[model samples]
Target chain A: MRLSENRPSPRVRAGRELPLSGKDLLGLLSEVLAKGVRIRFRASGYSMSPFIRDGDVITVRPCKKTDLRKGAVAAYVRPMNGHLAVHRIVGGTEAGFALKGDHEPIADYPVAASGIIGVVDRVERNGRRVRLGIGPEKGLVAALSARGLITWAFRAFGRNKGSVT
Target chain B: MTDRTGLDRIFKPSEEIVAREIEGELIIVPLTAGIGDIEDELFTFNASGRAIWKGLDGRKPLKAIIGELAAQFEGDPEEIEEDVLGLVEELVKRRIVVEVV
Candidate 1:
C-alpha cells in the first residue's frame, strides 16, 4: 500500500472551519494568547444569545488580572470539567469573579483569576460588528443579570423569543 | 529518479505563527495580521504533514527531509519527494514558511 494514500490531505486555506473539541480549543486558545496575539473564532452556542448568537464571530484579547472587572465578557476555563466558556462577569466572589450567561438564570461557579483566559473584545454577526453586550451598558447588563432581572426584563419587553429565559 | 535540483534549499517557519498539536493533529494559527484570525482562515496538518512540519527547523535542506521521511516510511522516494515539495510550496505561498536564502 502507498503511504499517505488514505491520509487526509493537509489544508492551509481560508474559509475552512475546524470542529475543535472543548479541550482542543482551550489548548489552542492558551497557546495563541500566550504569544500576546488576539484570537478570533466563531461562537458556537446560544448561551449568550441576542448579544452573541450562534455562528457569530468573537475576538478575544489577552487580559491581565486587573482587567477582570464586572460586566466584562470573558473566556475562562471551567474548573469542573476543564471546558472553556465565554460569559459575562456578573459579580465578584471571595474566590474570584462570578460569571453567568445572559440567557441563563444562575451564575456559574466562581472562577479564579488564573482560570480566566482572555476577555472578549469584539463580536461580529453577518459580517457586521456587534456592540450590544460589550459596550458601556455592560455594567447595567451585568447587574441585572446577577439579580436575574435581565430575563424578566426581556420577557416583559417581549424580546424573550428565541432566548433562554 | 526525481529531479532533486533544488533539494538543497532551506526553509524555516515564520515568526508570526503559533502551532499546537492536539489529538494527534497539528493546528497552525497565523498572526500575519498581528492577530490570531482563525475565524475564516485556519490551517491543519495530519500525521504525514506533521512529520514534515517538524523537520523544517531552518537548517535541514529539502532533500535531507525527504530522505529521512523515505527511510522511516515504506514508500517510493519520488512520491515522498513530491509530497514534501508540494507541502512546502503551499507553506511558502501562505508565508507560513520562508526560504532561508
Candidate 2:
C-alpha cells in the first residue's frame, strides 16, 4: 500500500548560478585555466564596448606569454586594485604590454606577462557569435585605441550611433 | 533501510568538474563541452552538503560515510544514510559523481 512511504528524499540542492566578486571570480578562472580548461562568463562592463559590450558572453582560453600579440583582447589582473579586467593589447613595452579600453582615451599601465590571465577567444551576444572586434582588423583597432583615437574616430565618423564593431 | 545496494559503493567527483570552497560554501562548475560556463552552469553546496561532499573521497564506502556523518552530526543513523544515499544518487545522475570500480 505504501511501498515508498518510508523512503526519505535527499537534501542536497544544486544551484544554477553563484554570484562572485571580481577577486573570487579571477581566482576561480586562474585555477581552472591553469588546468588547461577554457572558461565562459558574461561580460559586465562597457569598457570594451562595440567589440565586447556589457552582458556579452566571453570565452577565454589558456595560453603562454609567448602567445600574446598586439591587438588581441585579453583578460588580465588590473594592477591598480588587483581586480580582473578584459581589454585589448594596444602595444608593448620593455616592462610588458599596453592595454586600453576601446571607449577610453588612455591606455592602462604596462601589464607584465604574468599578470595576463587568458586571451578572449570567442564572444557571444544574443545567442550569436560576434566576430567583428576579435578578427584580423584587431591590429588596426589596437593601433587606433593605442593613440586614443578610437573613440574620436567613432565620434568623427558618426559610427558611434550604431553598433559598429 | 530501503535500498542498501549502494552502501558499499565509493564515489568520487568527476574530473569534468572544478570545485572550490569559498566562504564555507562549496562551489562547483561543470565543464560542458570542455568549457567552464559559469554564467549558466554553476552549482553550490551548503554546510551539511559540504560535509557529505568531503566524505566522497573515492576511498570511503557509502556505509562508512553514513556512519561518519551520523556520528559527527548526532543525527539518526537511518536519516543520515538516507541523506547520503539521496545526495549520491543525485550527483551520479548529473554525472558529477562517478562510482569507482
Candidate 1 chain B: 10-residue stretch with minimal lDDT: B1-10
| lDDT, residue A40, candidate 1 | 90
lDDT of 2 by residue, B1-101 (tens): 32325688888999878888765567788875878878677777655666788888989999998887776776567777777888788888777888888
* DockQ values of all predictions: 0.47, 0.29
Question: TM-score, each model?
Answer: 0.82, 0.83
lDDT, candidates in the order shown:
0.83, 0.80
The deviation in Å at residue A38 for candidate 2 is: 1.1
Model 2, which residues run further than 4 Å from truth?
Answer: A1-17, A156-165, B1-5, B46-48, B73-76
Task: Give the 10-residue window scoring lowest on summed lDDT in candidate 1 chain A.
Answer: A7-16
Residues A64-113 of candidate 1 have per-residue lDDT tens digits of: 98779999999999877889999999988788889999877788898999
**In model 1, where do residues sit more than 4 Å from their true spots?**
A1-10, A13-17, A158-162, B1-6, B46-48, B72-83, B99-101
Predictions: Cα RMSD each: 4.3, 5.1
